[model samples]
Target: MGFTDFFSDVWDTFSHPSPDADAGGKASTNTPSSGTDEESGDEKDVNKDDAKDGEDSEQGHKPSGDDDEAEEEEEEETVDPKDELEEECRNSQGCAQPKHHFDECQERVTGQIESDGKAKEDCVEEFFHLAHCVTSCAAPKLFAQLK
Candidate 1:
């Protein structure tokens, strides 16, 4: 057969397997009956083994929703160190003035942008002042906690 025909046959065999065939695309040797009592008896034994396996698998497997909820709870419990430090710095007495100045600058800049479609000045200086204050307060505390 040509290369395309060979691939097409392989795909068809995999996608639409015969009822009497195993997963490997070979005809099953353990046919239920061939008009013989012996083959029928063997089929009964095989069916019993399959039922036992199904029962074992059902007992072992847990529902997926429990795993998802457990994972989400774990994620919620964990907090990043950088975010913790930023919050601490924002709440510190040392950073209060700079934080206020930065907030005011941001509000003014946003208003200018809305009314004039652009602001002549960005709040980079105010942001830098706030960042500097936070860093000054946070760095010593961070280094003290480290090994």
Candidate 2:
């Protein structure tokens, strides 16, 4: 097996989770303990208190120094705007606006043209110039064709 497979196997061992792992994806037995209700109630109260504290913090510009930094890191991890826009254009078959549909197609093509891991400043300038020409040329033809 590869390095990833080995790492996965090791992780799977510690987790010991069954096929249908819970939402948290941790293993747990269904056996009820003596302090279950009390523990659960305490947890609920803690969650409520946490939520209230979070709300109060939101009202004020509290400098959650590392937490705010961590949130920014999470945002970077979650979505790439370029990739998302390309996917949107690629998967668009039932888009409503005619101009927008064409624009999406143009965007995807332009995106691929700059997929060489290069910066987009040059590509954006070229795309804007080309788009302006295409729009100016196509609109009159479209109007004439429709009439």
Candidate 3:
């Protein structure tokens, strides 16, 4: 996604959560709406659905794992650095690790980028610049344990 879309998503997720989200996505419609004014029957139905959802969560809410699958699919849709890195390492033997453990490295790198208040690409570029010391190292002792 472009930076605009990505940030818009972040803002949307942060700014507006379901009212009952913190309450485990449950709300009691029978407890009465805060409305001093009359609510339509359709509005009442929506409230009832929200209440029912809350009740379902309180009882037993087993996620279908679709969220997890969807997130995985979204990540796959993004340009993967591992693929690029692997392709870059193809010509040289022992120049890079047999495998790239991106998850652990990415977590740390992303955290640092956020904490340092640097652009994501800037941090990533710096990481690659430093990481090349290991990837292209001649000495086994100095070799980056990339896995």
Scored by lDDT, the top model is: 1
Model 3: how far residue 13 lies from native, Å? 59
What's the ranking of the predictions by TM-score, best on top? 1, 2, 3
Error of 2 at 11 (Å): 47
What digit string (tens of lDDT, one per residue) describes model 3 on residues 71-104? Answer: 8877856575555554556434543332243334
- Alpha-carbon runs more than 4 Å astray in model 2: 1-121
**In model 1, where do residues sit more than 4 Å from their true spots?**
1-76
Expressed as tens digits, the lDDT of each residue in 46-139 for candidate 2 is 9889888998666556667988888888784555444444444434443224446456666766686678554343445444544454555455
Question: Residue 72 of model 1: what lDDT?
Answer: 83
Better of 2 and 3 by TM-score: 2
lDDT of 3: 0.60
Residue 107 in candidate 3, Cα distance off native in Å: 37
The C-alpha RMSD in Å for every predicted model, in order, reads 12.3, 19.9, 18.7
Give each model's whole-structure lDDT: 0.81, 0.59, 0.60
TM-score of candidate 1 versus the correct structure, residues matched by position: 0.47
**What value does the lDDT take at residue 33 in candidate 3?**
56
How much is the lDDT of residue 38 in candidate 1?
52
What's the candidate order when arranged by decreasing lDDT?
1, 3, 2
Could you tell me the lDDT of residue 144 within candidate 1? 74
Residue 84 C-alpha lDDT in model 1: 72
